[model samples]
Target: MSSAHYDCTLSLTDFCSKETERVCKLICLITSTGTEMLSPTGFVVLSVALGFIMTFGFVNNFVVLLLFCKFKTLRTPVNMLLLNISISDMLVCVFGTTLSFASSIKGRWLLGRIGCSWYGFVNSCFGIVSLISLVILSYDRYSTLTVCNNNRWPDYRKPLVAVCCSWVYSLIWTVPPLLGWSSYDLEGAGTSCSVSWKVRTAQSHAYIICLFIFCLVHYAASDICM
Candidate 1:
């Protein structure tokens, strides 16, 4: 009822409000840092799916590699290209996909910054390898069907060169991100790492755009040729 008493009461209320606000902000920061973005169900489902894929891929690719090694006749250029693709796929399972499965199951990145960078680098490298392999496969098939109608197979040297080039190209593309041309960082629930396409810088955006175009064109070419 008195002016001094009313003023004191107002100060007390303001203090309580500020304290409450600070507490809420602290709670928010803790949650943001500590909790995963994905729900438990989603995390489990993703983990299971990745596990299945890695298992299936590892088994099949391993078997195929063994078969190629065992059978001399299966070691042709085309088959060798297939083997390279299989090897890349198997590496993806080992280095990239399995780690993803583990992290997804745990619902967080157990790997630190260096691990994240390596994961992104390996995944990107193998992914590019697989794409380039597919493109090479399609080209080989196209040449066989269209040009090699006389039933003569191309020399091993030709496909060998192509395979070598694919590796070089994959390295070329994946290295730029690590070298600061674009960038690699964790993404999607903090469980996986990849090119930081979310970064809005000019170089990063350009790299992302170029990568999208590169992938789209490679896949489209492979699909169309096949």
Candidate 2:
């Protein structure tokens, strides 16, 4: 390329990059400074409710996990499904709910853009994982009850594989927002961040519709399997 052409191209590229950065900063400012949606008493109530969910979820899931670890007899494939569910739920309680709870208590997002994104991603992924786990467990039980011979015990590897697939499936929905198909932003509550379902843009709409369809199809398939 000619020297003048090369210089012009580099300058254009640099300008675009700076403009993108500026827009991103503006967006972060608006989202992180979302107006509070709760009164003092309401905020207190929300905090208490969030605390309950986190504490109860953690305790129950941790106990189940501990039992599975402590008892060999409880480590069967069916119980393994429970263990997977517990682990996912525990993650939601910690990585997902706790961040939202903290943000809600503070009346705004203290963690900035990265925190909101991470919070949304972890919450979405783990929530989907837990749902898939439940479906798998239900299917396992249904198969046990409906199978003809019912003598062959399911192997542990099968459940492990199912769990792995569940995580991957969850990622298919959660990761796209991070990649710019849509985005995570503070919800109406002003503290919790999640998929920007309210955005009216084409990409945001498409992502929401696709995610809804995926969930519906998977639920139907799980039901049929069960």
Number of clashes in every candidate structure? 0, 0
How many clashes does the backbone of model 1 have?
A: 0
lDDT of 1 at 125: 90
Across 1-226, the per-residue lDDT of candidate 2 in tens digits comes to 3222222223344434765665444444544444436677787888889989999999999999888888888988888778888999999998988987897788666788899899889988988888888888888888778877545775788899999999999998999999999998887567788888778899999999888788657666766766
RMSD of each: 7.9, 10.3
Query: Which residue pairs come into collision in candidate 2?
Result: none
Q: Estimate, for each residue in 78-193, the C-alpha lDDT of model 1 and write its tens digit.
A: 88789889999999999988888889989888888788888999999988888888878887787777773664664799888888988898898888987889878878777888
Error of 2 at 177 (Å): 0.6
Q: Which stretches of candidate 1 lie over 4 Å from their true place?
A: 1-36, 149-154, 222-226
Candidate 1 at 93: error in angstroms? 0.7
Q: Candidate 2, after superposition: displacement of residue 80 in Å?
A: 1.2
Q: How accurate is candidate 2 locally (lDDT)?
A: 0.80
